[model samples]
Target: MKVTRLSSKGQIIIPKALRAAHNWEAGQEFTAVDVGDGILLKPKKPFPEKTLAQVAGCLKYRGQPKSLDEIEDAIRQGVMEQWHDRVDTRE
Candidate 1:
């Protein structure tokens, strides 16, 4: 196991070998969790924040899109079918 000394500024230098192995660079962020005996350091996500535009076309639809009235009618039909099924099952 590698040993490291915590500086007076409360900063600990991760060993060069370990840092190279983990590919951790300068300004890398970490989240520290307190365990019973020691602390666990987890690397923070490196990805930038995503916007709606980035995910806008995630789902692809080749066919024509349904209108609002068509969508509502489908929902009503489904509900009526479910209600009729339940009533028939009861009788």
Candidate 2:
């Protein structure tokens, strides 16, 4: 078991062994949660959520890639189609 002494300022110095084990560096941010008898320290930053582009790796289509203009046009067309569909459904 590891031991740490609390200073006068209510700060506890994490031991070198524990720091090294957790790859914790000086000035690293952590979230301390009080778990009844003890505190749990966790990193502030978790892994980012996955996105469709990331899952696909690279786009499947081949040939001359669609330019920004083409992509924007496709998005506008899709939105207009959805809007018209909604309008038509309303009678």
Candidate 3:
């Protein structure tokens, strides 16, 4: 296991090996949480926040619209394929 210590400036220097292993770079943002006796650090999401109004219909379909039956068949086939894939992986 690796060890780290908090600095005098209320900052912690994460070890170089662990940093390289996680691909964490300088200025990486993290959210620290108190988990009972120890702290948990999670990387901050790297997405620019957007609302439904801002992103809705951005990927407009340009093809001819399919019937409701076609959509249902596609969904059913996708579910069956996924189920078979999962069952195969369990073996």
Model number with the top lDDT: 1
Cα lDDT tens digits, model 1, 1-91, are 9999999999999999988999999999998999989999989887866899998889898999989999999999999999999999999
- The TM-score values for the models, in the order shown, are 0.52, 0.47, 0.61
Model 1 global lDDT (CA atoms, 0 to 1): 0.93
Instruction: Compute the lDDT for candidate 2.
Output: 0.87
Name model 2 segments beyond 4 Å from true.
46-91
Name the candidate that leads on TM-score: 3
Error of 1 at 14 (Å): 0.4
lDDT of 2 by residue, 1-91 (tens): 8878988999998889988988989888888999999999887776666788787847478688889999999999999999999999999
Superior candidate under TM-score, 1 versus 2? 1
Error (Å) of candidate 3 at residue 50 is 2.3
- What lDDT would each prediction earn against the true structure? 0.93, 0.87, 0.92
* Local accuracy of candidate 3 as per-residue lDDT tens digits, 10-74: 98888899889999999999999999998999888899779999998899899998899999999
lDDT for 27 (candidate 1): 94
Least well predicted 10-residue stretch by lDDT in candidate 1 = 41-50
Query: Which of 2 and 3 is ahead in lDDT?
Result: 3
Candidate 3 overall lDDT versus native: 0.92
Off by over 4 Å in 3: 34-38, 64-80
| Model 2 Cα shift for residue 25 (angstroms) | 0.8
